[model samples]
Target: MATPEKTGDVAVHDEIQPAPLTTTNTIPDEYRELDNGEITAEALGGMVDDLPKGYYRSMSFIGTMLALCLGQSSCYFGFVMPANVLTIINEDIGPNPNYVWIALIWNLTQAVAFVLVGRLSDLLGRRWFFVGGQSIGLLGSIIACTAHNVPVLIVGSAFIGIGAGVQLSFGMVVGELIPNKHRGFGISCIFVSALPLTVFGPVVIRSMILHMGAGWRWSYYFNVMLLTVVVALFYFCYHPPTYAMLHARRANHVSPWKMVDFVGVLLFTAGLLVLLLGISWGGSMYPWKSGMVIGFIVGGAAILILLVLWEIYGAGDYPLIPIHLFKNRQYMGTILTAAVGSMVYYSLLVLWPVQITMLYDTDSMAIGWKSCIVAGASLLGQGACGVLVRVLGKHKLQLMVSVSLLTAFTGAMAATTPETPGMAVAFIFLASTFLGYVENVALTIGPFCLDASDLGLALGLLGATRSTLATTAQAIFTTILSNKLVTNIPKYVVPAVLDAGLPQSSVTDLLTALAAGNMTGVPGITPGITAAATEGNKQAYSHSFQIVYLAAVAFGVCGVLAATNAPNSESKFTNVVQRKLHHTGFDNKTTKEAEA
Candidate 1:
């Protein structure tokens, strides 16, 4: 082999090349020089030479698959655990007060941490932060497991949120290692693994809570064990990709200080934390018009403005978020669609179980099992879409179909009434399935638009967007439900009580008693008041569901519009040649010159 020559910032090989054995074997002339002074044939061959002779025997491949599986399992476990037991916790701890703030705080904290940690990991490597986050989460789990009060549980949940933020860094790391041809398959596989977890996690948690006389604390303990194992495995077996290794190999520059974006991070965190806290507490703890709420909103808005100004003007070329990425029409569309989809999906997850318990008078275990039907359907939908993408090669079409189905289901759900048939349960399952398809499609599509180097940031942004939207959606939906329930309960129940021949003065007492889940407070009421109150409770729940479903329908329609504008599957770029040609002005002449 002849000596490699430097051209501009790239190296070029001057020796003859060998025949390509696989598509990935084709090294573009730009990277061909980085082959360490070897001919193209030698360099390209060496890149993939580490593969095992047989697929099953490849320990590295197996490890990678397990890592992906664990990642999805952790995400599914984290999300479904809270939804399964939220109603029970509220009933036990809330004492008739709305616990919507709990949901909002969990989501908001996760979003804030995800963006801050993601950018930090991008600058500082993923190892220590990831390990430290898992440790903190473990401590939180211990606190929650041992907690006797709601305040302690909320603190524990905050730890879980921080851990989730740290775990998101793995998405980018996995993307970097997987081959382009297998990238979609790898992602799909990870997502598919979540199916079992989502379907069964709630069921198992609820069962444990009921059968063992355990509280929600046991669920936290289970998660602690699982996460501890995961942390240990990651610490011992995995090595995070370094900034120097990623950029230096490609002849790109790395500036540690610029990459950190400390000011941008601080401002972003402060803004998001304040905004989420305000949203969580407003209408639940403090009235929306209260001074505390106003202060949080105003403070958060100010911090957000500072973040935007710093990123746009003061950061120069090293802004934490490369705002230019948002200019891509497909990127913008996908992100918007993801936000709306998350809002609808997560709100339903939080509210549906409560509705089931209130309407059917079911126990937590039954509600948990019923919830599994939706997640099971989602798993099926995701799997079916993944196969369709592989065969029909129409990712966007699948996404559109999924969004349309979700919109229809949500719209139908909005029309539900006290007399709505039990068969309406199928709609929840269908909606979940469609939403799952939307999520899978968006996850696959977002990364295709960016270079491999930016995959981590892309995944982080996706998580952040989803978390933020979900937090706001939970708050809005909960407020609507609480207000409507508070108002409509009297209207429907008062009439029913009067018709049942109960004393008129007892109406207010009956409602207050029902809201507290106690029936002993009303005086001069007949035995029929219990039946009338049950009917009243049903009506109140139906009304809340009606409003929730309407909001979900609106969100689904927005998601559909966003998905319709997203790029088609054919626009995906994978090969080094395609990426280089797209970035630099690579034409046939440049290719021929490089060959010469």
Candidate 2:
């Protein structure tokens, strides 16, 4: 009556016969009729020798580490390194309003790329996308390095985001290579691989920007070097089975174009873009109630609703995003976790650095060191999570523990007023450590919850969620911070400025400068007024960050709720491919121990 539990990851190496999709009645026919023969070991195209079922256990570690290191390094290169010198870029561009487009364009495009690339890779293969993303990223860095104007830099940022988006899907590729048991450790290693960059990227970039004649341009040049390294590693070290090798035997003669739900793609991408475009504009370029903002926001939401309808009914056989995926409770729950973690992660990525700069007497190097604490703690947390999952075999517990810490620490951050350097360092490290655990657990558990066929799409969906939510979070906090400053600066500094002997003629200009947060830098303010204005600005930032931290706390609480909704999972990894092989009688000798 008692069934044995699965003790270890499924080690199935031989490719299983394609199973019918569980939920859908129709399968897209594009690759279905293409290659009808089974993929023999010789189909490797001279890439490598035949790897056995569960072969990833032996050769998988080193191969996975290399791929992860290269891929994630390229991806985060867009996210992290930019924050190190955003202010410098803003200054160099003469504080142009359009400068925000650098990050805005990058995140928007990256969000689109994440979903589209993931969907395509599922149909085609991941190799060319991997190679292409890095190549394009490298090209972007080159352009950015030489950029003389803000528009040129914005173009370069677009390339960086687009490439990084595709590179991000490599997580699923890594997921495919490793079995479940050691997969968390392998994922941890990928996050850890960025330690060197996180530790040194800012310091080096800041020094280059501040002292080297190359200025902020050197930041992109360094990105180029990192991208070049990833591309090189990819060629020699990467070799995974293509979708064609695995499923082309089942291909129908349907045109690939017919299989592509272009309408869905358009609706999905346009809806998000318009929504984010509206969000980005609100409280920054335009008022929230402005016609342009309201129209785009309403229109984007309506279009997205249309997308849902089409995918569910109208798309017939070819929905852009497979509709059944949304029905998978595990996939849906964990993907929301990814989105919330991203929202928290990205908002802090910008806000924390600003908080540290304004609250403490620190230079960019000091801020860089502070950032290293986060990176180091994340690596530590991720590595430790792998161990905990191995010993305890409960990833949901890890998720719970992570969100608990995140919620508490974020609450603490919200409470601590006038944050000192010591407080900033300690809080950042602790919060980041917990945040890292949450992310690693979500990402690692994602593939395990779905059938192998859905890995790319699921991960793509997660990638899209992460980017979109992050952008949304950024908009939310940027509005909160800017709105607060606009409200509070007058209350705190105006009386002080008017109280000073400055002329009444200067009042309008003074309010304008204060609103711009140029309290000290505004040209005509005397030393006394400048210092008072500085204090007022600092108070405004401090209060604004407290609100953001509180929001982060709310985000963490939502992560816990989301994790609670996860479909019950067995503690360790299940090799779906191997399990399917066993079920189909292809591997009848499956040891009882394999099922534990």
Q: If scored against the real structure, what TM-score would every candidate get? A: 0.84, 0.82
Candidate 1, residues 225-329, lDDT tens digits: the string is 878877775665444444443334332433566567878888888888888788777777888899998899889989988888898888765578777777777
Cα lDDT, model 2, residue 28: 28
Off by over 4 Å in 2: 1-67, 76-79, 93-95, 235-237, 252-258, 494-530, 571-596
Candidate closest to the true structure, highest lDDT = 2
Write candidate 2's Cα lDDT for 237-341 as tens digits. 555555545443333333456657889999999998998888888888888899999898899899999999989988866577877888778777887876777
- Superpose all Cα atoms of candidate 1 onto the true structure and report the RMSD in Å to 1 decimal: 6.9
- Per-residue error for 165 in candidate 1, Å, reads 2.1
Worst 10 residues of 1 by lDDT: 578-587
Best by TM-score: 1
